[model samples]
Target: MLLFQLAFKYTKSQLQRPSYWLAVLSFALAISLMVVSLLVISAYEKTFEKSITQLLGQIQISYLSPNISLPKVLSYLQKEKIKVAKVTSFIHQEALLVKNGKVKGVLLEGLPAFEKKASSFFLKKTLNNTAITNFSKDRYGAYVPVLLMKDMSLQLGDAFSAVVAKSMGKNDFNRKVLKFYVKGVLDFGRSDYNRRYLLTSFEALQKPLKLSKKKTSGARLWLADKVFSEELSFKIQKHFSSKLIAQHWRQWANNLLEATKSQKKMIFLVLLIILIIAAFNIMSALFILIVQKTKELSILRVAGLSVTSIYAIFSLQAVFTGLLSLTLGFALGYLWAYLFLLIQSRYFSVLSQIYKLNHLKIGLPLWDMLIIIAVVLFLVLLTAIIPVYRAGKNSLPEGLSHEL
Candidate 1:
């Protein structure tokens, strides 16, 4: 009781100084910066992961053998009893597009109709979210992303000519010009999708690629448990023959994921450095306070309080300061993080286009918050230990003889 009262009184006295407030501010800023950075990075990763998985599925089963049929691989998957959400077939080819005197090279994506199983899976948000997909039912129709239209100066209902390579001899090829009408314009927000992708139907694509009903270049498999994508991929590789290769979605979005991970690490390192400096500020403040209060501590020791009890007074002050900082810092961090998220969602859609960020979301990761708490508490404890040990080491006689 005596020690706590002394601790409370001491903390109250220290609050009068501007340095104390500055230390608390530093702690709060550091916490807010780190928490916001962590939450933003987490949200980007989740959003991008969803976009890529929806487009490529959790696992892609691609085979080099032209003789391998989709039905055969599906039957094998069924026999293995592997849980799946959806299976889709995809075919893509590089072609030159000409419209309005503008010639641009683009990747043409051929999938089944929107009503069919193979189509753009943009992760529909609502029943009425028609813009999530721009697949046209007409075999002669093409869906163009709006960003690409701007680049090519194309509008809806315009004619697009694709220069596709067709096999003439066993090793020679000829360029076949195919014409189609623009069906719709898309605004999917991903850079690759906007700038490079042209949506076409399977019926239209098969004529050029010479693909039969049973054969496709690659098959996409969506799992009921997306978190186990890597595990399922490994299992597929082990069970399937050397001709079949399974790749996880991360492998497809490697560049994006790697950039996100690297940015996160760099930002974390910067914030951690800031927090360490803030902790050092606390250390300095506490040391100064201990010196200023040495006479009071000497009086207590002279009045028969044990050295341990005198040390307890300072240690308890540190605990109090640490807890107070933790509460304030967490509140500030949460506020800043959500506020930034709100700002981004409400106002930064254009900016997101500049960065190729699509389907960005706001999410709070509990494990990350827990880690921040643990780190802050550990630094607080370290800050307390060094000063308190110094206080405890002062001889009773020396304290008693000290001048105020």
Candidate 2:
């Protein structure tokens, strides 16, 4: 009880000093800056991952044989339905879109109706709170990439036509032409996909291509769980006799994922450097405080306090400073994040010029918070150790007579 009272008294004395408050405030500012940076990066990564995964299923199944029929593949997938989340069959082909001899090459994707499976999948994966069954039910609805529309000077409800060709010789060539009214425009973040791709109903493409009812090009499979990609791919490949090629979505966006991972590591390293500097500041402050309090510590020793008790008193003061900084820092950080979000929301046009986002998103991961707290506590303890040891080892008269 006496030791506890001494520790409390020592910590209170430190807290009452302006220099101690300034040190605490500096540490808090440093911590808040680091935490806010981490939160911003983490939120960006989370949103980007969701956008990418929604645009491309976590896995895709393609034909090993170029001319493989879609019906057979659908049957195979149906037989292994337990492994897949959803299957979206699509035909992707290149076409020349000509209007008044202004020719442009486009990548056309023919899938289920814009209101059907594809739209549902997009809503489910991207929007999170929407239902797929509520999408528009227009039979001829088509989706065009924003870049494609911009290149063609097209608008929603504008009529556009394309000439589809097969790989056969000129005599055997069939010209498939159809006028389509633009239903929606997609703005996938990838420039290539945005510039080249168009989406339309599978029924619209099938009849124009004269494909049989049993034919389809390939299927995109959303795995029930991402971890099953390898095992399920192997099982499908073995069962399908090399007629099918299974690819995980990670493989498709490997470059993007790698870039994100590398950037995250760099950000962490940069923030860690900031935290290390803050730790050094804490060490310096504690050392100065020890020097200033040398006489008082000696007086405590003469009043029958043990060396271990003296060490405990200083250590407690250090811990109190650390905890106070952490509390104030976290509160200030959260307040800054909220204020940022509010300002961005109110003046998105102006903020977008700087942040490249419509709104500021700050997400604090629980594991990250725990790790940061642990590191800060460890650094605080380590920094205080030297000063505490010095106080414990110094002779009472020496400490009383000399500056620390």
Clashing residue pairs in candidate 2 (N, C-alpha, C atoms within 3 angstroms): 70-216
Which lDDT tens digits does candidate 2 get at residues 1-404?
A: 77677667766777777877787887888778767766766765665555556655665677778556656656776687755667677777778876555779987778765555555433212212233233433334467766677788877666667878864675787677755666676765445666677777777677767676556667776667777765776676777777777776666656766876787778777877777677777777788777887888788789888888877877777777788888987888777777866875786655334323344446888877887687777778888898889878888788889754
Candidate 1, superposed: residue stretches over 4 Å from native? 1-17, 36-44, 79-81, 113-139, 172-179, 207-211, 234-245, 253-270, 288-320, 323-364, 390-404
Tens digits of per-residue lDDT for model 1, 109-191: 77766434323444222122353244344336667776787899886666678888877889999887767666666656576
Q: Which candidate is the best by lDDT?
A: 1
When summed lDDT is taken over every stretch of 10 residues in candidate 2, the lowest stretch is 123-132
| lDDT at 398, model 2 | 87
Candidate 1 lDDT trough over 10 residues, lowest sum: 123-132
lDDT of the candidates, in the order given: 0.75, 0.69
